[model samples]
Target: MSAVLLDHHRLQYLHEAVRLGSVRAAAEALDINASVVSRQIALLEKELGLSLIERLSRGIRATEAGALLVERFRKWEADQADTVAKLRELQGLKRGHVDIVLGEGFVSDLMSGPLGRFWLRHPDLTMAFDLAGTNEVVNAVAEDRYHIGLVFNPSADPRIRVATASRQPLCAILPPGHALAGLNRPLRLHELVDHPLGLMHPSYGTRQILAMAEAAERIALAPKLTTSSINVLRHFVKSGLGLTLLPAFSIAADLADGSLAAIPIDNRLLSSSEACVITRRGRELPHAAGQLLRFLSGQMRAFRAGEPAAKMKPRATRR
Candidate 1:
């Protein structure tokens, strides 16, 4: 093996080639000619005495050895970035980036205040906020695509470590002056079935739980309007079309301002939801992200402590 072949340039070329899956595509992405990219990859293979890629009609794919090396290189790159973040922390937290992806439900009043305060404390720090579904957020964090994740009712997986979690029960959302608005007790699942229903799409965390309840009771749910967006469900509810089911945090402001009525559900399966803050298992987060995570944990704790419990009627007949 030639010592020159172990340099950063050759390794970078190999990484790009595997990532883009074609020498020509890698060259285009890197703004270099195809010949330069192919020559470096050939030299790398010669030095290692192994073919790194297999050409195909459409593009190229990495050999097993090449794939393993690229995986290691990515981990090494992450470790180097962590080291730099730590060094910046010693320099007084002047500058760093925190990448966070959360469920769209969190974009509402749930996170606005705490995140605003976090930014105020570190004006020089940068953060990127992305909205995705709960499961997608969990997957993104587990894959190390983001430093922090906030999601609802995520699956039990070994790849993610939950830093803070709060159990939030499902609530029945009713428009102001609706017939059910005056009830202080928990509403039964059967009680809500007769009303016109506007449900979040099946992909949402709440809808998943609702589906379980429907099967458990041998009942069918016929939503008059189905949408993937929470805002659309809220809009439908506000227009007096039908009641929608949501976790309490999503309608906190609406309930507070007398615009909506939030009733707790009495059923066991749909009684509550879990809101979690997660990070990749065994991976140390960057300093900026870590600080924000701690702050978020505290905020969740305080919110849970201060939030009122669901009002439920005593169990008797199903109705």
Candidate 2:
């Protein structure tokens, strides 16, 4: 073939056929007849003067020429999507959407206050928030799955760039009328070793930090109860099951309402955690998402500074 014009529909059929490993499957996915899909792929192969796929017993595999074309075309599709999203963003804040992913630890009064405030300002803008583990949040942001992410005690990840971070102290959460609630000073590590401990699962960053603190002090903390849910831990502590340790932001409302008392940790290793707002390193966020990112970062800083004094009502099934 000397030269060829790009036929978008035919190229789409070929891309789908390669992706699904069968023309019939691609046709089914695209809600079209199988013969049309097959014919389109044949035309694309003839124009390109290349055998684009190798038929297998069950399905198929893309040949070398097909693989390279598909890869470049996917990149083109991504760039085109980015360009369209940018265009939509220019219509003003009232019409666009922002997708956010965050860890369960951040479903707090601190978050709700800012979220509520922002939505009230841009009532028509759509927002989707998803909960994942800290590491998952980072990975999702790096993979461009979300416009922004919030993670507690986030570690260094080269694929992501931190937009803002606030140091959150890990505090001992004591139930109302618990013995330790009366203490004025920060709690020492050894002081907590004997308490009936309710803690988050070992996979949690907070729990990992607590473990390190225990190891440094030559003490092993056998938690009486362990759960993956921060809300569960909060409720357990509130019921006087046992003391639990978490970031101050996670339980700020409980502390304010006198349901739980927060005593700062004295150990340097366990003193504080970091809550960071992160985005993909090189990709520029859409205008609305970028606005929300800055808003969330400010809210984190405000919470760290102890600005919002009133008890904030929790909303929805958070985290």
Candidate 3:
């Protein structure tokens, strides 16, 4: 391959290789031979004057440079799709694609039931999900990352159309053996100041809620553990590390199983808020995004209807 040549195919290969971690697996996905995939990677490395990946015992790993390239190309791929969608939309086509950018929390719960059904009903639409923080969500949509983005506790932004999906109340996640494991009544935020707490990363929506609590009480919480995965945070709480603070819906499974407890925070620290669909100004979504939007809307409605806030009692399912 020529040094100046930039092939989207090569970019796709690198991205897939990174995600699947196996040239053979990636080749299988692309329906090509492993040797062909290896040759393409070699060409890519030669063009960049650096190895993009290394063969691991079980799979492969991207070099730092390779990782950066792959991430950038992910955006590039998205941009190409957007361009195609827009050009068609300009030519008497109101359908092309729908980019449904969402946070990890929404991915876990709101994506499947109703939203998935919506996708099935709309065959002409296509959709993609991007995960990022509030600022990134706003920026990406502003920069046309996807037709729409989901923002948690979204602040004012000129980049995209924002909507409120849900305003959930912050709650405490307690472990099984904890004395407060069975309580469902609202509790004060300051009450948890002394107890060990597990917190999410500063970039996450949950982190913003905790920050508000810290500012209101004029104190900072020194968590025993901090993480990105809400599930892992719940796991730590279940393991007796500490408690966590987030909206009631985020940990519905844990609460139902009695492995964790959700207690409302009465300190008025944060009004629980999370991601919702956002579309850029002057941007018309493709068939996929519109389908996804209706899907997500339905999902959110069903979520509100089926998942209710009830006091959970400690059950035998406690882990």
What is the C-alpha local distance difference test score of candidate 2? 0.75
Model 3 segments more than 4 A misplaced: 1-96, 123-126, 182-184, 272-274, 301-319
Model 3's TM-score against the true structure:
0.63
Best by lDDT: 1
Query: On residues 1-319, what C-alpha lDDT tens digit does candidate 2 reach at each position?
Result: 5878868788778788887889889999999999998888888889888988888998778999888777566545645666777887676435778888887777775465788898888888887889887777887777566888888776788878988877666777777577776666667778888888888776677887888888888998889998878898888887877888877677767767778777777777765566778887877766778788887777654235433223322211211
lDDT of 3 by residue, 51-152 (tens): 899899999999998888876786676667767866786787645556666666566566436656665665566557777766677777765656777656
> Could you tell me which residue pairs clash in candidate 3?
96-286, 96-287, 97-286, 97-287, 98-289, 125-287, 125-288, 126-288, 168-272
Q: Compute the lDDT of residue 21 as modeled in candidate 2.
A: 88
lDDT (C-alpha, whole model) for all candidates: 0.76, 0.75, 0.68
Candidate with more favorable, higher lDDT: 2 or 3:
2
Give TM per candidate: 0.77, 0.72, 0.63
Candidate 3: worst-modelled 10 consecutive residues by lDDT: 310-319
Residue 52, model 2, lDDT? 82
Query: Could you tell me how far off, in angstroms, the CA of residue 171 lies in candidate 1 after the best superposition?
Result: 1.2
User: Largest TM-score belongs to which candidate?
Assistant: 1
